[model samples]
Target: MADTRERDIIHAFVELSNELVDGYDIVDLLSGWTTNCAQLLDVAAAGLLLADGRDVLHVVAASSERTHDLEVFQLQRHQGPCLDCFNTGVAVNVPNLEVEAHRWPDFVRIARSKGFASVHAVPMRLQGTTLGAFGLFGDTPGSLNEDDLALAQALIHVASVAIINERAASDRDVINAQLQHALTGRIVLEQAKGVLANEGNLEMQDAFAVLRRYARDHQRKLTVLADQVVNREVSGQEILRHARFTSIRP
Candidate 1:
């Protein structure tokens, strides 16, 4: 039975890991983390928090609104395992919330009211940098088994790596697209120069000079104007009408 459960959990793990998209939506990213945490870890519910660029953390996603409410309860009460784990970048595992006397008074009361008997918080972090912490609520008491704890920690690291990888891929795609645009512009400039000289009976050198001066005066890209000319969309007469070239003619 245990082996089958473990396999089921691992299958869910790989599936969610594969769902990771570069530059994923914020809600979808956090929701996936919370849902997977509950699925792969021995917990009844899950919650996720996020730190914005300003370093303030917020409850960004939760498996249920009830979980969101409990997280909000912790935030409002200002004391809980999640806060501790977030600040210290460590896991906080409360085996039983109902009967644990040495608990965060406010957290225990709220969690007991919500019918969650045990709670565990694992820091979602990367390389000593703490982003936030994930919360796991259980219906029974007793600390997680060694395997379960290890799996939770591993998932946190996976979440962090996925986020970083997604951001890097997004940046790379943007740069690659800009480089392609630049090369395309160069080609259009070449095509435009050919058209200008061939149509106006001007030397290639003088034709290029005329094109540059016109673009500069009009505050347009030479490549853009070149595209227009090559397509017969604009005439050299229209372009040179404003300039006096002592040694050049249209």
Candidate 2:
């Protein structure tokens, strides 16, 4: 009976595998995974967790309000099957929450209170780098069958690819912007240094020090003052003398 049910779930998981292309919506993709798993596998609920660029656990998508609550519940407790899978790079298959070493005491207490009798987590990772976990909760107490575990594991692999791909794309955008930002700041700083040196008859390095100090002291970005000086919009008397180089007050 379980085998037949698991096959249906596995087939849908395989069907969803084709949709894991780049640029696919992260929320929608994972939500679909949760929905399909629940319906086909007889699970109570499911969710996928992913680490953001800053490595914070974010519940990207959920199947239901209870699933949403459960994800938050896991994060808040910080000691659950999902965390184990994420940290250890191993799957956690707690078939019966009531009978065990209670590896996830906090998690089990809450899940049991909510009427869930079992839980499972599969890591979304390759070998070294784990991006997150694929979590499952069930109403009846008994470990997920071998077939169900296989299906979930397969689904987890596909989810990892999609997640890693998305994270890479997001990271690329950030890196490119940061490079552009740094390059622009350097150009402006260099231009400001020249203006300060020319006006003060001081060495280029000293001019930079003064600019740096003043910008830091004022808690303002150096680019703003640098732009003004470059455009001849401000004087350099204080700049030449290394006095507090203030911008032209309108």
Candidate 3:
């Protein structure tokens, strides 16, 4: 079992390293990172939260629907382990959510309601600046073993370096603008997905497929297309028209 987990961790490293290539999508890359973390770390769920230039943290990716909601709630209420990790630029290891009631009353309450018993949050840091945080949620109340904690920290360090290198390749203002744009676009995209799903009686994944397919076929940025949907510049039905037979990766 240990050997298998070791192999999985190595594979995850390779996959994350590959995301450093040109033309990689930051959102998709971070999303994949969370998925990989959940699978390899024996966690019930995982998530990534990035801080914008304004120092406000926003959810970037989530490994599962529940974790997604958890991260969203963190951003909404301005409290959670991930928030603490980012703000302090250090890891926050909570062996049990119940024990954190005094530290994060609302967050712990909601997390417990979601069936999460523990959490570990690692800061994504580069050159003294914390770009974000990686959160791991567990169903049982226990801390990550030292080896596992070290591995998680290493992975996050690599991710931070990759993100910083990518941003450094662009102009300062351009990177800031891009980060702000992605932040706003993600919120709009989430709303648009809900609108499309409800309107078309489709699953959220299917609604996202419709939106992604339309954007790819039309040579438009996914967020730009999402903005259009939110602004009523395009109809959800138009996206649904092409959802069938259109398979999107990431």
Candidate 4:
């Protein structure tokens, strides 16, 4: 089992590294990191909290539905291991939640209620600056073994490097701002696709094509137009009405 787990982690690294250079989606990359951590590590769940360029942390992804709820609760309370990790630019290893009750009462309470008894937070850092934290949660109250902790740190380091490298290549002024916008754009695009698919009775591919056409016709940024669609400022029917399809020649 240990060998298989190690192989899986290696495979995940290879997959992630392939997208590190260009045209990589930050939201997708971080989301995949959380999912992979939960699967490759012995953790019951995982989540990622990213600080925008201004050092404002946001819950970017969760490994599962319940994990999402716990992460959301942490964000709402503004106190948790991930927050500490990001703020201090160091790992916060909480082997037992019950012991940390006094320091993070709200976080402990909510985490316990959600069936999480332990958490390990690894900082996503480059040089002296930290961009985010990856959270590993377990249902049992015990610390991860040395090997597991080391593996988690390695994965976190790779992810942070990929993100920083992407930011350095962009024209953006700050890492957090750039990452936040990229993540938000992904969310908006997904929402717009769903709206179009349901309203126009179209497949996901068709809905995306319609969205692209509308953005081009209006000379609007695709991400901005997607946000408008999600906000209902632009309707799905409006995009469907303007989309033009062409046949491909064999």
Q: Report the candidate with higher lDDT, 1 versus 3.
A: 3
Model 2 whole-model lDDT (C-alpha atoms): 0.66
Report clash pairs, candidate 1.
Answer: none
Best by TM-score: 3
For all candidates in order, the CA lDDT equals: 0.69, 0.66, 0.79, 0.77
Which 10 successive residues of model 2 have the least lDDT summed? 241-250
Specify the highest-lDDT model's number: 3
RMSD of each: 21.6, 18.8, 3.7, 7.3
Evaluate model 1: give its TM-score: 0.61
TM-score of each: 0.61, 0.58, 0.79, 0.73
What's model 3's TM-score?
Answer: 0.79
Off by over 4 Å in 4: 166-174, 186-250
Among all windows of ten consecutive residues in candidate 1, which has the lowest summed lDDT?
21-30
User: Would you list the rank order by TM-score, best first?
Assistant: 3, 4, 1, 2
**Residues 1-250 of candidate 3: C-alpha lDDT, one tens digit per residue:** 9999989988988877765754555554565677888888889999888878888888877777788888989889889899988888888999989978999999999999999999999988765666778899999999999988888888787766655565463455554565666577668778888988888887775676677668768867777777789888998877876665564423
Candidate 4: worst-modelled 10 consecutive residues by lDDT: 241-250
| Tens digit of per-residue lDDT, candidate 1, span 1-250 | 7898788778766666665642333233445567777877768889876554545556755666577778988888878888887888778889877665565888888788887888888887654456678888887887888998888877777766655553443454443343344335545665676777776676655566677678757766566787888787878677665445533343
lDDT head-to-head 2 vs 3, winner: 3
